[model samples]
Target: MRTPLPGVAAACGLAAMLLLGACTATGRQASDGAAVAPSPADEAAQQSTVDTKWGPLGPADRDLIVRVRQAALWEIPVGRQAQRRAARTTTRRNLGEIARRHAGSDALARQAAVKLNVPLPDQPTPEQQSWLSEITGKSGNDYDRTAIARMRTADGLLYASIGAVRGSTRNTLVRAFAEKCEPAVRARLKLLEGTGFVTGDTLPDPPQVASAPLPGNPKQPASPAPAATALLAGR
Candidate 1:
């Protein structure tokens, strides 16, 4: 159930630069790999391409930002628990934490912590998974919360998962993002939102670990709009 996302700029952009693919200012790509996107000089001239959604990142909505980030990472839907079961892993949480911490510990830092902070119940927590089941009753389980019932994990992968808020519908924010959340969050969550920056890689926290198949692993911009594929896993 990976949403048909737009190509991530970094991934696709690098492909264009390194792989010889071409990309446009709005993100569409060309076969030549030599097309001109906005050069730094071009980007420097425009008004700040502020994502209107980030304006909501103010204190009152800290709660929503926390959840939207969470749901997007677990973009799996409901019903088909097996696929969710098949895809479950520590990757999202682990990589997610890394992305955030890479950004610091200060108030201003965590705010920029990219990646969502919505919580997921752990491998040992069926009741919690059940809670998730109640909400998204008709979606794909590939990335659904219900995947926890038969969650799997490999030995080498480290894991961590936690929630910034307690007892949220998780779906509340998912719908917002699925429909349309904020542009800034998508563009800069990892860069300017999450934890304070760090110089080295650190293992994601343990207590936060949850149901899944593999170890942990692991946002946005302004202008016309953002993308679906980019927002999904490939990004």
Candidate 2:
């Protein structure tokens, strides 16, 4: 039988009042005195987004910079290995170009990291190292298949991530890096796919967007800027 529930109801009401009071004390109340949660934009605005002179350096911006460095750390080795071990001439030539681009990308990543005061990992992530080890253990056709498949899959994922960062990043340096990286990464994916090893299994499921315009095909590559040359020399 509804055992005189008045006291219990009053106690529950008191607890609810205390919770609302705590929220209001923290300045989380609306004009009408009701507690309201902060919007995502408001929360982000409250945090320090502008951490560098280049502009707002968000977490995603820092991540892209680190990823470029890390990609070079492992991809450069695997690319060189594939250049030597791949069975197809196209694969070797493509991987060689990819390795060379990564060297320049790595230098740029380092320069960006220095400007942003972001520390980068010296080695590839464990998963990347594992992929390297697996490819290293194979040879001839097996090595070609393993390296191409792995690199294609990785490049597909990187391509999507680069697009996400490039579109949303507020930092100028990060945007520049993304602009350069997106094209290079897409070119690498195309190179890998052109080798004819990237079948349905190697391609990322739910295919990533590929709307970024291709860079101009220069007859002869331009020499590095003096500042860029100096940066590379310092490294």
* Candidate 1: stretches off by over 4 Å: 1-57, 73-112, 115-128, 132-235
Q: Model 1: per-residue lDDT, tens digit, 1-235? A: 2221122222223222211212123221234333346566544432122223333222212323333333332322222332233232342343344334322222222333443342222121222244345434534433332232212110001011112211222233322432333332333233212222211222211222257666434323335546676679654
Most TM-score-accurate candidate: 2
**Alpha-carbon error at 61 in model 2, in Å?**
0.5
* Tens digit of per-residue lDDT, candidate 2, span 22-121: 1111113344434457677655543335667778787567666776887898899988977888888988998888898888888888998898887777
Those runs of model 2 whose alpha carbons end farther than 4 Å from true positions after fitting are 1-50, 207-235
- List, in order, the clash count of every candidate structure: 48, 0
Candidate 2 colliding pairs: none
TM-score for candidate 2, please give it: 0.66
Q: What is the C-alpha lDDT of each candidate?
A: 0.29, 0.70
